[model samples]
Target: MTQAVAKEPAARPRRGPDRYVPFTEHMGVVRERAAAGEAVFSLELREELLNNHGRGHGGVVMTLLDCAMAHAALSRVNYEREVVTVDMHIAFMGPSTGKLVATGRVTGGGRSVCFCEASIVDASGDVAAQAMGTFRYRDAA
Candidate 1:
């Protein structure tokens, strides 16, 4: 299937010094409902986000996982600051199609590091991919 994330992409290069979610002219990949650290971001999937075989690209899946993981990690923090991804492991279970939603929750919290896990679901409500990640609270550093 062709899984595409069709939200207006940020003008910033994917790999750049300003990697901490650049503010975009458009709502871009990041939105309010998805920013509260509790809600999920739903992106419409299309062929552009597909792989060689036309399946959901691993990069897109990983990005979604990372975003969700950050949200989950942020839920444990009381203050606002950047949280760097320490580690992230994702397991692709099924092909992602249509609207892809990702939800994250904190598994554990600490003074220095936080552990979180998130799952990406397809339109059919099946988990297309799951992620477990650890993040270091920027302010805590």
Candidate 2:
């Protein structure tokens, strides 16, 4: 009898406008341009993003915070360079419903690393989560 093996699926190449930020497309994140070293991202509440308790999932909120902080760090560098998360800390303040908005700003940094802070706000403008992150800048290619 011949042995059978399972294969993992291949990663797909990103295309179109979201190529620079592919996750934004997958997560349905929308961006609002901000000043240098700052970023703003938003998403609408959907059933798929909700947890069993009918609130936004913590993982999704964390992802939004991370992405916002990463974008803030990236804004400080050349477009050809990308920022990778080094360390992150987050705090959940409350449940999130309706439209969610995350805003991030670079607090401090050096040549290769940046420090950033972000907060996720619900439709009522209440902070649902806060996060701090350290990111390292590197060449895209």
Predicted model with the maximum TM-score: 2
Tens digits of lDDT, candidate 2, 1-141: 999898875665432223445666677888776458898989887999999999999988999998788878877773446778989999999999999999999999998889999999998899999999999987766
Q: Where does candidate 2 clash, by residue pair?
A: none
Model 1: residues with Cα > 4 Å off, grouped in runs: 1-39
Off by over 4 Å in 2: 1-18
TM-score of each: 0.73, 0.83
Which lDDT tens digits does candidate 1 get at residues 45-82? 67777788766788887887777677656655533555
Among these predictions, the greatest lDDT belongs to: 2
RMSD of each: 9.0, 5.1
Give candidate 1's TM-score. 0.73
CA shift of 50, model 2, Å: 0.5
